[model samples]
Target: MRLSEYQVRFRTRDLLAISGPDDFILGEGRAVDSSRMFEPDVSPYCFDLANRSLVCVSTADISGATFFYQAQRQYARTVIKVPFESLPDGPASPALIFSIGRCGSTLLVRTLEAAGMRAVSEPDFYRQAACHRPLDISL
Candidate 1:
């Protein structure tokens, strides 16, 4: 759902508990809610491997036309930290798209989405992984 469609209120402690350890937590998170962590719109915005934690923020409605970083910062109030070990095992095989700059990759992704395929455009997690060379986790 689009972030604007719903009021983004800070969840209450009881609600957080009911949402489960993998869904919500009080204050800064020590572990990520695995379900929300994997959503298409949730981007792993920061990583602190030494601390074994990463921060995720929602990016709903972000598209090729949007300024990614600017929009992310505005929508970052819901950010939460997740420990490395809390991350679930990835799919045995995952599909990916790669292209050089100005190659219409974004257009291709948009087209695919129009055809009912789920795709994320230049996700921050991918960029983070690329910049943070020699990552312990396999890409």
Candidate 2:
């Protein structure tokens, strides 16, 4: 199937970039506006309740959009409600490291990688969500 000119130009950016929760406002199932970017989207990637992981999918095809790797820490925070906790019942002692910005976190990660330890970094979904929502409005 071929895309129309309007559709081709209509950029499909992430929900955060284009719209907010109120954009999906409805009265008796009638949409107030067709142009608003956000609707009550039920994307699996947005929130995985079962796995307790919020996945942000940013496409590379869009120009000037925030890339996942660039805002790794912020994106990590957006996906959750509670402060991150360690897995209590795990067999091994998980190496949890924290540092201020510009410190050697990257170097530490690299060193761990060199030592053959699998290192998982920034899951900042909460921060990303803050950036997405309208600051003036209340949730």
Candidate 3:
């Protein structure tokens, strides 16, 4: 989806497109659901937003649009999303992150967590910074 269109869609629907370790999309594929996999796709509810149709290219093709999903849908990338409460203490290694933008940054933090590394994201870096009170006291 085009960034502009995505903006509208995001607002319209409470949906998030995540891509690695605990990827909702990765687990959103037909294969994940044994029953669904057994049953052939009869609805053919594919999302074909290509050919000047506000297409946003990913590694995989998202041919259909749906209201709800049970399986993890495979996408162009991988995402490992852990709830904030589940995330570990901060100080995520800068080197461990390959973040340059919004999505990349989120995936990076998850990657670090999956790798059993202690890290925090740029957004949460302040938490780490704020954790330490000044050694020198001032009025």
Best by lDDT: 1
Candidate 1 all-Cα RMSD: 10.0
| lDDT tens digits, residue span 13-107, model 2 | 34334222211212232122321212222111232223333333222222122332333212221211111121123457766675665777667
Query: Model 1 misses residue 124 by how many Å?
Result: 2.8
Q: Please provide, for model 1 over 1-139, each residue's C-alpha lDDT reduced to its tens digit, 9 standing for 90 to 100.
A: 1111122344333321211113323353333345767676776655655566666666566655333544554454566556677777778998988877688877887898899987666555556555665555553
lDDT of 1 at 21: 19
- Which residue runs of candidate 2 sit more than 4 Å off their true CA positions? 1-89, 125-139
Cα-lDDT of candidate 3: 0.28
Count of backbone clashes for each model?
Answer: 1, 15, 22
- List pairs with backbone clashes in candidate 1: 22-33
- Best of the two (1, 3) by lDDT: 1
What ranking emerges by TM-score with the best candidate at the front? 1, 2, 3
- TM per candidate: 0.61, 0.32, 0.20
**Poorest stretch of ten by lDDT in candidate 3:** 1-10
